[model samples]
Target: MTLLALAGCSSPDGGSQASPTITTTAAQATTAASKPGSRIFGLSDNQTAALDYLTTLEDRHAPFVSDDRLLALHRGGEICVDLDNGMSFSDLVASWKPELREDGAKLYVRAAVEKLCQDNRSKVPA
Candidate 1:
C-alpha cells in the first residue's frame, strides 16, 4: 500500500519539487487495517525494512532527481517483480486501489517506492 501510495504521487514531468512527506497518521494506516486484503497494514518486518531502505535512498536522491526518472525506476521495478512473480502489474495495483484512493497522498509516496524498486531490480528472476 505504501508503494502504491508513493507510486501514485509521482509526476510525469521532469520538474523538481519537494517529495511528499509520509505521515504515520492513523487514517493512513487505518485505511490499510480496515482492508483485510491489503498488503500494507502492519507491514511484515521485511516489508518495513525494505520501505526504510527505499525511504533512505529517496531522502538522499530526491533533491537531485526528477519525478519522471523516479517514476521510470518504479515502473522498471514493477516490471521486474511482476515477471519474477508471474503477476500482472494491473492486478497487483488493483488490489491496493481501494486503500490508495487519494491521488495526492500517492504523489508523496511514489519517489520512495521507485527508488526501492530500482534498487531491488537485480532480485528479479531471469
Candidate 2:
C-alpha cells in the first residue's frame, strides 16, 4: 500500500523535510509474533499483541496513514493477515477504534497493523 504519496512535502512543523513516502508490499510486511495468549482489560490476546507491536514500531517509524484508512487497507488486502494466527483481523481493527483520538499514536499503530496484516496474508496459501 502507499504509506505516503506526498511529493516534496514539508513537515507539520514547517521547517523539517518530511520523510519520503514509503511503500511496502505484502512480501515486505513480515513481522514476528511476540505477545502470547492473554486478554487484558477485556481485549483479546491478539488485539493486545497487535497494539503492543504497533506501539513499538511507532517509536521508530512515523506513520503516514489514519486508523480508519489503515483498516480499509487491511480489509482491501493492501495489508495481509495470517488465518493461522487464530485472530480475527476484523476484531483487531475494531479494537483500534476507541483509541483513534489518542494523538498521533493511532496513525503509527494503524501503519504497523497494515504491514503486519499484509505479512500475514502473504504467508497464507494462495
Candidate 3:
C-alpha cells in the first residue's frame, strides 16, 4: 500500500522519474491483504480492493495495458486525487483515459472513484 501511494508522486512532465519498486509474489499480495495491519507485502485492504476492482474491469473487456501491477494501481490513485481536487465526472472522463475507448474510460473512472475515492461517489452523476 505504501508503494502504491509512493509511486504516484512523479514529475508532471513525464520525465525519467524513478518508480518505487515493490517485489512480492502473488501469494504475498493475497496474504498481506487478508490480514489486518499485516503489511507483509505492504498491500492494505483498500489497496487490494482497488487492484481487484481493476481486474473486474479487465473481465468486462475494459482492460488497461500495464505489465506492472503498481502502474495500474498508481493510475487509479491519480484518478482519486483528481476527484479530491474537485474534478467532475465529465472532466475526469475526458482527461483521465489516455489510450482507452469511451466505454473503457467510463469503466476506469467509475471503478477508481468507487474503490479509491468512495467519499466522492454521491457527487458523481448516476
Q: Backbone collision count in every prediction? A: 5, 5, 1
lDDT to native, each model: 0.39, 0.37, 0.60
Tens-digit lDDT track for model 2 on 1-126?
233422244767787575644443433222233111211111121333344444445454543346433343333222223233454545544454554434334443344444344334433332
What order do you get sorting by TM-score, best first?
3, 1, 2
Per-residue lDDT, model 3, residue 6, is 38
lDDT (10s digit) by residue, model 3, range 1-72: 434443565688876577655465667655543333332221343545645665656566666565455556
How high is each candidate's TM-score?
Answer: 0.25, 0.24, 0.57
Candidate 3: misplaced stretches above 4 Å? Answer: 1-47, 66-68
List the pairs of residues colliding in candidate 1: 6-109, 6-110, 7-110, 9-106, 9-107
Which residue pairs in model 2 clash with each other?
Answer: 80-117, 80-118, 80-121, 81-120, 81-121
Mind sharing the TM-score for model 3?
0.57
Candidate 3 residue pairs in clash (backbone atoms < 3 Å): 1-42
TM-score, cand. 1: 0.25
